[model samples]
Target: MGAECCNKDCLKPSVIGYGVVAWLSSGAALGVGIWMLVEKSTYSALLASLFYPVTIYILIAAGTFGFIFAVFGCAGAMTDSRCMLALFWITSFVVFAALGSTGFLALYYHDNVLRKDINIRQAINESETNGLKDVINMLQAEVSDKLTFCLLMLSFLS
Candidate 1:
């Protein structure tokens, strides 16, 4: 008589756990991206370039793909399927690269392109749309209030 033994996959649990975390984070990213695009859209008029909306669009795309990749990862882990795992790995890499590039480009545009090209005062003055003007005025008031608050805090501390 012989005793039978079955192989145990030790990494399956960790993979599924990672997939769950990734899925939640991706959903958050998607939500934030959509929210920014829809709610803060008026602020886009102040920008001289398309980078603002483009970055948000990229975030939305990456989040959507990340969600899909996480599903693949969870499915692969559960089924012990190599093909799904490979797809997950590849999609994850693509999403990572896209996010990294978007961050880099945003920083570069803020420092170089925005500073040189965008004049907030000019944008506000040239804005023909009432909504854009209202948004600009609102932002100016908010900034003024924040600056006043900061100054008061500093005076109190000193």
Candidate 2:
């Protein structure tokens, strides 16, 4: 009889298999995140948004779910929990499928091209607000980076 220690042994009959699962799942998720962030350069929250169609970017949104699955599956694998792995796998599949289907639906609803209509008044407001957000994020990142570097330098000097 297998000893059940906090549901640990119940998770994987094979520790080796669990390790493999975690590695592969985590690797796949890394690839997905890289493709989305690096290849597509979605560095900003506005660009990171999943609510919009991938057609808006036309490069990397297609694989976003794969990365999510990989990441979640990797975590599950690390934890040796069958539940998390299954949850992430199924959810990732559903999300990917939905994104693909939604892309098609957009073809009909938006007539195959993102509408370019603009309300001048709204445009002005949006431009103003978005600009401030962009500036804030940039400044925050810069400040954070500087702080980290200074701390590292201080540590080395010490």
**Predicted model with the maximum lDDT:** 1
TM-score per candidate: 0.68, 0.29
- Against the unseen true structure, what C-alpha lDDT does each candidate score? 0.81, 0.54
Candidate 2 per-residue lDDT, tens place, 1-158, comes to 44555365655444435445544554554465455545344334333235343444322343455444556665776776788778766866665565467557556656322332223334545675665356556757988999999999999999
Worst 10 residues of 1 by lDDT: 1-10
The regions of model 1 sitting more than 4 angstroms off are 1-9, 113-118, 121-133, 136-158
In model 2, the number of clashes is: 0
Relative to the unseen true structure, what is the C-alpha lDDT of residue 91 in candidate 2, on a scale of 0 to 100?
62
Off by over 4 Å in 2: 1-69, 109-158
Task: Write down the lDDT that model 1 would get.
Answer: 0.81
